[model samples]
Target: MTDTALDMSVETGAASYGAASVKDYVALLKPRVMSLVVFSGLAGLIVAPGHLHPVLAAVAILCIAIGAGAAGAINMWYDRDIDAIMARTQKRPLPQGRMDPDEALAFGVFLSVASVVLMGLAVNWVAAALLGLANAFYVFVYTMWLKRRTPQNIVIGGAAGAFPPMIGWAAVTGDVSLASIILFALIFFWTPPHFWALAIFRKVDYSAAGVPMLPVVAGEAETKRQMLWYTLALFPIGVAPYFVGVGGPVYLAGSIILGGLFVLSAIRVLRSEDHKPAKQMFTYSILYLFLMFALLIGERLAA
Candidate 1:
């Protein structure tokens, strides 16, 4: 090859190497968190009073999953600096320079808009509106406004995560109801204890990153105190679907047992000095939410 041709070949190779892999784009979605969002959205669709066509239901879930991914990518784009400082998030695609910030931001915005539009076309506009609102809240409210400003950031921002069930319910019924609101309440209350557990262990990271997570802004003792309170509040709200007769006895039983365990875990965190309870709480909280929703799904299927 001539010198100019060799130079062109070298530049092309470098560009190819610098391009983001598919896996990197997927990682920008925060797929593990997306899994939970998808599952919860599915549970909402299943337990709602009306029926949706299976194909449309799948679309609804897909939109929710994509919307979640979009919001997460936006969050990653905005938080790249702090993300790089935090040990737990330091390996993410943006922090590692696998993708440009603008690329991630555009990817997130595209997914966010596409997901809402798809939901509106395939399902109902109600669901689409809720999805749009959730994405907006996560991006504009939580990520931009509240995240760096307050210790109560996640507390208020938790509502953004709590909207999936309502969206799912709206997918089927085209309207919200008391049951859907109760489902929303379940997640809203659970968010504090669940995330505070993680914040307890990740306090150093939050501190170093200059993010005022509860454990970073308040003392651990106060954070533990709040976790226990939220867990207590969650107990009644979580089991409400059963008392409302939407779920059968099986659900009621599971809710009581799981809720008791969650409260106990919070109590342990409060009483102990080690991070073990907080760590355990963080791990089990995921299981707790999953099984709690599973009970509602199981009862609906069985009925």
Candidate 2:
């Protein structure tokens, strides 16, 4: 081929590849995480002791999911640098040059604004305000500031994730309550141990990225100990729903069994030489939370 023709072909290939890459950027919003946020938020809405129109409830859940996705997008945009260095995150959209960082930023901002506005107009201002705060806290406080700064980042930043259930409750009640706060507390306390287990296996990624995860900063032994401690603390809070009168015997029974299993897993992690316990604890944690909320909903529905 002539030199001019070869150059033109190369340029065309580059343009096509660039277009294809943009799709990957959108994937970095962590749709799975958004799904969990939506599900848990819906559970809260369903269990809350109030009557909301079906349409309004659906709108509230939609806003919560979109706000969470926006926060995830912003997190990806800001953490692109660190994400590039981590093995687990190196293939994310911005780091892989699938999408422009500015494009992601603008998309996140647009979603954040649109979600909040829709939520406020359709539901109560209280829910919409909480949604806005959660997004800002995740993007600016957790992703931009804390992720690289301290081992306690997950401990504090977890509040962002904990807000969804409370927002869901508030959307129906039009205010916050002790019951909503308890739901928030459940997720808040659960987050550190859940995340620390992953860090135990992924310590090298955090070390390479200069992120001070619990395992990277506190060492495996200390992280395991903390996980055990948190799991034990979680037991009481997990059962609090029963005393609060929101949960029935079914929920109480399930909470006790699940909480015992969680504590046992944490103890095994502390005792085991291999990382198998941590891995098991991490996987089971997802199941534990899902079942706990599911039982709560079942009780409410049966009542």
Q: Please provide TM-scores, in order, for all candidate models, with all chains considered together.
A: 0.95, 0.94
Residue-level lDDT tens digits of model 1 in 39-118: 88988899888778999999999999999999999999999999999999998888877677888999999999999999
Give the alpha carbon lDDT tens digit for every residue of 1-303 in model 2: 798986896676543335435456457558888877887798789878889999999999999999998899889888889889999889787777667677888888899899999999999999999999999999888998898899999999999999998999999999988888898899999999999999999999899889999899889999999999999999999999888876889999999999999999999999999888888999999998889989988889888
- Displacement of the residue 24 alpha carbon in candidate 1, Å: 0.4
Off by over 4 Å in 2: 1-17, 20-26
- Clash totals in order: 0, 0
Report the Cα lDDT for candidate 2.
Answer: 0.89
Q: After superposition, which runs of candidate 1 have C-alpha atoms over 4 Å from their true positions?
A: 1-17
